[model samples]
Target: MNRFRQFMSGRYGFDQFSQGLVILSLVISLIGTLTRSNILITVSYIPFIYAIYRILSKDINKRMKENYQYTMFINTVKGKFLKGKRNVTGTKTHKYYTCPKCKTTIRVPRGKGKICITCPKCRTEFIKRT
Candidate 1:
């Protein structure tokens, strides 16, 4: 245990990106196994190997940056999905529109016909039927 700790002292170790890669590898391996595909089983090693490489890498800054980017990408995807969920849930009660100038989403109450909508972010006005 002590020797392993010493060996890993300068290594980047496990992180979110590494964990994701490992999970992806396992999922691919499972699918490959179910289908009995030799090619897919071989392909599953790619992520697992890269994850091991990342875990053993000594470049801390580069590993941190990679993790940061991966997290940011995940956050953006989650945000979009949540936004879409909200829009779907609010479809009957509220109307959703994107601001032309700032590209911000504006939510307003429905049934107000031919109203001029003002963007809260950019103050741009556009007429839309509700």
Candidate 2:
């Protein structure tokens, strides 16, 4: 028992949060699978499998976080415009760009071409070369 505790403590010391997420996802997945619900299965299983792979595989966690954040950011931006809702009056249609330096996504009004922009997170300036 002591050896098992020591091994777990060492192997997953700082990974408890991720481990918990993985376990929770797995439980959801199992429930979905048992109930044979397609949507629930996809919602619960896919991310659970991915999280497990990300946690146990050779992929770096930072890279996983970046990839997840980028995907989520893109999804959020896409959802906003695709929902058939217009922005507040006086707000122009905006084009969004992800900062190469700090990964901060910025939105600028459309038709602004060949401009330089600075990222708030990294404070790095780069041309919008679009």
Candidate 3:
């Protein structure tokens, strides 16, 4: 146990990307098993193998960079989805709209019908009903 721990001491053992990879691999493996699909079984090993390689990798800097990139991409997509959901189910106190000129998001108080909106970033004027 001490030897194993020592071996893993400086390793890039886990990160969010690695965890995601593990989950994806497991899901693919399980689906392949359930459906008895040889192709999925083969596909599942790709992530599993890469994950194992990442865990055991000794190049700390490269691993950290890759992990950072993966997390940033995930966060970008997740943020957009969450932002869309928030826009769809806007709070009763405020309404959301996109600025037509600069495409910036504009939030205004609700129940103010037929209001003129000015883009704070681009200084473009538009009319909307809130």
lDDT of every predicted structure (CA atoms): 0.96, 0.66, 0.92
**TM-score of every prediction relative to native:** 0.91, 0.32, 0.87
lDDT of 3 by residue, 11-113 (tens): 9888887898999999999999999999999999999889989999989899999999999999999999999888888877889989987899999999989
Across residues 26-122, which tens digit of lDDT does each residue of candidate 2 receive? Answer: 7887888899987876787666665565544454556456556756776897887764353343246776678997887676777867989888888
Q: Arrange candidates by lDDT, highest first: which order?
A: 1, 3, 2
- Choose 1 or 2, whichever is better by lDDT: 1
Which structure among the candidates has the greatest lDDT? Answer: 1
Give candidate 1 regions above 4 Å deviation. none
Per model, state how many residue pairs clash: 0, 0, 0
- Looking at model 3, the pairs that clash are none
Model 2 regions more than 4 Å off: 1-92
When 2 and 3 are scored with TM-score, the better candidate is: 3
For candidate 2, the 10 contiguous residues with the lowest summed lDDT are 8-17
Better model by TM-score: candidate 1 vs candidate 2: 1
